[model samples]
Target chain A: MKAIFNKKITFVIIGLLGMVLAVTVSGCKVNEAISSKTGAQLWGENCRRCHNAPDPNTFSPEQWKTVGMHMQTRALITNVERDKIVAFLQQ
Target chain B: MKQYITIITIALLTSTFAKAQTKDTIEVQKIGDKYYVIVDHPKVDTTKQFAPAPAPPPTISKTFDSHFMVVGLATIGFLNTWSVNKVNTPTGVVSTKLPTTNSFGDVAHYEFSPMFLWRHSDNILVEFEPSFSNGSLGVNWADITYFAYPGVILRAGYIVLPFGTYNKRLAAGWICKLPTDPVSITSSPVGSDWGIELEGGQQTGKMKVNYDVALTNGFTLSATDGSIANPDVNAVDNNLGKTVTGRFGWLPALNSGVEIGASGLWGKAGDANTAYKNVSTAMGALDFQWVYAKKPVAINIKAEADMQYVTNASYSNPNPPTVSDTTYTYKNLSYGYYGMFSIRPIVADKFFRNVEFAVRYSSYQSPKGSAFENRQDQISAGVCYWINWRTVFKIGYENLITTNPDNNELAITNLKNTQNILYVQFSVQF
Candidate 1:
């Protein structure tokens, strides 16, 4: 009876440690996704010439609405590319 | 009981090993996002151990060209012509022979002049001037201006000071129109005196002001003394002086695009003859300009009234008083005033840019105490054609009327009434 009780206690401790490790590892994965620099690298390769580094304060929300409409003709940026560029600028 | 305990322990150890392996795999995937690094534990910090990616090399743009060249010259001419005919005493007959005695007479002549200018940027400018006439090689005014800024320009060399628009355009040919009341038209045009000048000014809103400060050597005021037979005694040189002139202009929003301005000049005239002291003169002027345009047709108007006051003038003869005894004393105070108007109307708009019809009127008065107190009026109508941006060809007919006061010392009992003049001029610039 004593041996069985010891085995059960050991199993419970092992299970709790497994759960804690999984939670910690999952947290780290989420942090890495948020901090990745892939978007920055893509921007530097594609668009750093005529268009200066994106400045968020240059346009207000209302101004950005108008700017997005004309961005295709002025900057030659497609809709998908414009959206990504805008997101990076906002960030 | 011991066997049951061993089996449970084995199961727990197996489960713990599997969980640890699964957690290590998850941490490896997380580290892969950074730089494909594999980590075996969640608690391990890889930030300091990871090396940053190298920065990319700078790229050069394709459209980069960097080379340019510019080159330019300015020429000015000051011509003075005097044609004097002697008159027989009793019969009052005019002769081309040189007069022996000092007598009041009439002189008429024409002057042709040209100025060439070239400039390369604001750093350097070269000027050449040639004045041609049937009589003698005329005078030339040449200068180079180095602009330090838009407001300040430094000029070195010789120049003819144009105190007014008329002085700038007409006086090069006609000197009798000197706008002083006590007129002295008989000076020399070696008005091409050497000088250094600094002209600077600013324009703000409707007001503009400019100041010209010049230091001169061998400067003369009037060419009236040309009548003196002995060129040695009459001709003067090697004089030193300075002149400060200020011009202020205002453009009011009224009067149909008219611009009005006033200018004042004060300076000391160096005594070319050492026996006499230097004289000081004060001059003032008022000017008005107007512009009118009808689509392709345009007209420009400029009018000016100029006055000069001369004091402390003394006559001196260097040739041991040959002409007159006791040093030829004369009254010092002199004044002159004149009004002039120029009208330019565009005649052709398409091919010829400056082809225009122009008419000008001028009237002058000399003061009583001066040797030349003659009232002269002129009416001129002309056509001007522009060859380029800075060159022009002018042909004109002028009708001149002269009246000397009955009590004037210079005017004879009877003088010629009206004189008609026809002139053609070609001017070029670079």
Candidate 2:
């Protein structure tokens, strides 16, 4: 019975992996859309996904630059998004 | 006499002009009653190195604009608990009440975890966090990452495992909606470990994909040769085989605010030479998250479930009723899951906008044959007021129930234990 259940789990895992591969392959053919967005739009949408949206005045441009880089690593945001958010915060 | 005087004056003037050309000169400019001194540097035929080092820079740290930052979180809270026990009697069931126990750390207590980060370069970042909770201190995570490209990264050192959403992303005090974690998430945790990981995310047209793969020193058996327990983290690998774990996540479209992820781990979890040496373990998890932030209200929802399977193995009991029955064997399997929801009103009033409410349900189970066989169910609800983006005050209550399998005679195994707790806490990230 355990072996049978393991096989089912294996199939589910393989299915998920197939989906991941499909996304990876499809992403290569289309234009990256996140680059076309405005800094304000990125700032509003991305920050709220995890915690509250931050006040722009909370940090200086220098600090916001670091914060943007940190979020790129922490939240898995793209470099373009980080730069745009930093630019918006600095503005 | 006129000719002689003219010659003598011309010669004297020529001598004075020659004297002024060779010597140093100083000029002072006055602006608003303040004099600025200017010293003219004489033409020279020499050069000098002001900050002389090895001819070429030796280390990368010398030329980069790096930053050393300290960020942390602190929470202080109070908790009150009530417990009840039940026992089997000759004729019927008997109920007993214990004194209400007041504690500090069971639900919420004083906790401080500070992260130290070093931005070594534009592409490399090193981070470590030391945590102090209740009365003990431990290092939460320490790791270094190199962003090799836009969507690929290399990481090493004590890295957080890519199992579930909470431990990697939402375990911070400022982010978690409630005062305590779901009981189910804690029971079957593949938390951070000493490992090397490759992780990254890419926006693929409409769908987004992210993945993390790791190789680590996996769980190990206890040193005391004790039976009936969960595997523990080993700083050093006790066996030749290592654990492999990875998580894959996908979002259907850009700005979807919805993501589904799956994670799996497999490896040997035993010492090199023993009867339990051949024990193998496998684990799998599925997680989902959604966040909606629009006109009238903002809502967040998340869920995660995990299952673990281990090959059957026998263990030496720490204590035996009879010498003949010193070893016991059982099937090893366990599973757990949790679901959480939260909402905040986004209205004109500032006060109401910062107010939020959340609830969670969690359950865990181990089969009858396992040494640590039991079942648990918990429900937690909380209300919070956000002081700022990174600060919050929360009041929460939780009820938990535990049921044990049929047992012979053991001092520790119980029929049932039920507990209810109420707590309030203030948490801030800085």
C-alpha positional error of residue B67 in candidate 2 after TM-score superposition, expressed in Å = 1.1
TM-scores computed on chain B for all candidates: 0.55, 0.81
Write candidate 1's Cα lDDT for B247-342 as tens digits.
444434322245565555555554556543355445556766655555556555667776655444444333322435423234333333333333
In candidate 1, which residue ranges exceed 4 Å CA deviation? A1-91, B1-121, B166-192, B206-208, B221-241, B249-259, B270-275, B313-355, B384-395, B406-414, B423-430
Across residues B1-430, which tens digit of lDDT does each residue of candidate 2 receive? 9999999999999988877665546667554445655555455321231122225435552334587778778888878888887766567666777678776654236779988878787788888888897477877778888889877778898877878777888877788889888877777647778889877777787667787778888767543332223333335677887787888887765784888888988767778887667666788889998989887989999999988877766666556667887766666778899999999999999999999999999999975555567899999999999999999999999899888765552223457788888988889988
Native-to-model Cα distance after best TM-score fit, residue B148 in candidate 1, in Å: 1.6
Interface RMSD of each: 33.6, 2.9
TM-score of 2: 0.82
Measured against the true two-chain complex, the DockQ scores of the candidates, in the order shown, are: 0.00, 0.41
